[model samples]
Target: MFIEHPSQALNSLFRDKPYQGVNPEEAKFLFIGLDANYEAQIDAKPIFAKLREYHKDGAAFWRSHQVHHPFLLPQYSGDGRFYHRSFARIGFTPEHANQVSFIELLHLPTVGRSSLVPADLNEEHLSKLSQIVLAGTAQHIFVPQAVARLMHATGRFAWLLKRPSEQFGPLGILYRQQAKTVYSHLHFSVYGKFEARKINEATAIRSLISAGI
Candidate 1:
């Protein structure tokens, strides 16, 4: 959890925009599942850095912008590891309570006795996650289903494959497209491909609100 000041160019790219009447407190919590390997990469640093910068900015941008609701990083340390250690606890003070909390799903280290086990969705941790969301402490959960699936297929989480395509815009574009064919089964509002392509941070925030996340 290294925090870096945003450069002028980065600041200009994320300048605050006019609010369309959306309130931050009322905004839905967006839980973002970051790929561990992807996050470790040098290029991906900017994305996380930008997210941190946006939250620290604390202006109108804070009002309209949705924080990465509960940042869940997978744990990858310790011998005979059975659980994922949270990065929030590893890099930053775990006591800094806020509207959002990030959880890191720890993975097994490469040199460990065994490879990282698949995250147990049925575990008490997940039950607690649901409780946290139900308590209004959390808003919405965003898991990169594609990345999760890939991780399931392969024992390792590949960073390059998990990186979002900036050639488009906010990573939500990829989610929106997939939401149509596969995600539609979840019964959430299915914004069409045309609408999905237009998603940005603001639009994603609105969608989370509209979806009742």
Candidate 2:
């Protein structure tokens, strides 16, 4: 399951008065996404440190892993080869790397310095790259596509199609179309007023378990 903030959220889940129906032990995997440049923020250090600790523990406990967009990682050329290597270092087996059960980080380039929206990239190119990422990291690839198509057919894509700056929600919907079925129990905490608070990891995990991920 995707745990937006497994560290803090987990604590909250374990501490909140009455126990809920969720069982944490049932979680076999945890996928985490972190902002690479989070350390730059003076106030974000403590939270980031906690997240790193949680990441290490989760990786050991559930063989969990992480995926970061190019913008989040250190300086590196935006090349497919670089991505392949990065994925390997994150513990993706060669075979798994070519399948749909793995996690992926999608990156988009902005057109100008003042722009918050991403550049209008070629859809075909994005699709091709997305296909590669899915094939290498997914176990149930068809489900995500089906979800996206269903959403698209029903006009849900209309809302998702808006640029990040234009809409406060759906910033990560593109990746939703490529997740494996097992990872469908995923949710992203984008930069917005509503999600202003950093995600608490434990809480996210409990929520996922409750949701039957």
Candidate 3:
């Protein structure tokens, strides 16, 4: 189900917050998602309340979340949970994970793929997202395909849809000029196989980052 908005408590608490992660301005990589995710049994209110308390410190936020969040658990480079596996495939080491930042286009934690669509974003939300992205200093930006498409359609992030791009498997590389940072358009789950060929898109993305492309 699509949530028009999170609970009043959550909205009021984090209305002004735009991103998550440690030292976003200094981080080398950014992993952007649609929103926070939680299972049916999880109560978002208290979870987010704690999240807000640790908002000022990304490291603490992540460390605390590791206690109950399965996604934060360690995984090897392949054949594990999709979330951490994709992280590994993208060249994100455990230490490197702390070095990167993760931002969500929307607030509220939900189970499964989010039902929140692009049209749900109002002008205020769009402005905040644009400002956050344009101001961030991360050299490598990884944006999910759905979020990228949403931004493109809204014209808030059309710069990512420009040329000087390359398509590798399911990933589309959109080179940004600001500080030579690159925006990678990737699968929503960040894991997929190219139907036309046998290529691991996440690994390809990591290779691109390694090649300094």
Residue 125 deviation, candidate 1, in Å?
3.4
Off by over 4 Å in 2: 1-119, 139-179, 182-192, 196-213
- What's the candidate order when arranged by decreasing lDDT? 3, 1, 2
lDDT of 2 by residue, 97-116 (tens): 11212221212211112211
Which TM-score value belongs to model 1? 0.28
Please list all clashing residue pairs in model 3, or write none if there are none: none
* Model 2 lDDT at residue 69: 27
Which lDDT tens digits does candidate 3 get at residues 30-142?
77777665444333423444545544555565555542123444421222145544454555444443556766766554455556666656667667556555676676677
lDDT of each: 0.30, 0.29, 0.55
Worst 10 residues of 3 by lDDT: 71-80
Superposed model 3: Cα runs more than 4 Å off? 4-18, 44-56, 60-70, 74-81, 111-113, 162-164, 167-170, 188-199, 207-213
Candidate 3 lDDT (Cα, 0 to 1): 0.55
lDDT of 1 by residue, 43-79 (tens): 2443455434433442332334332211222222222
Better of 1 and 2 by lDDT: 1
Model 1: weakest 10-residue lDDT segment is 180-189
Tell me model 1's lDDT, rounded to 2 decimals.
0.30
Which whole-number lDDT from 0 to 100 does residue 132 have in model 1? 37
Q: Which ten residues in a row have the lowest lDDT in candidate 2?
A: 17-26
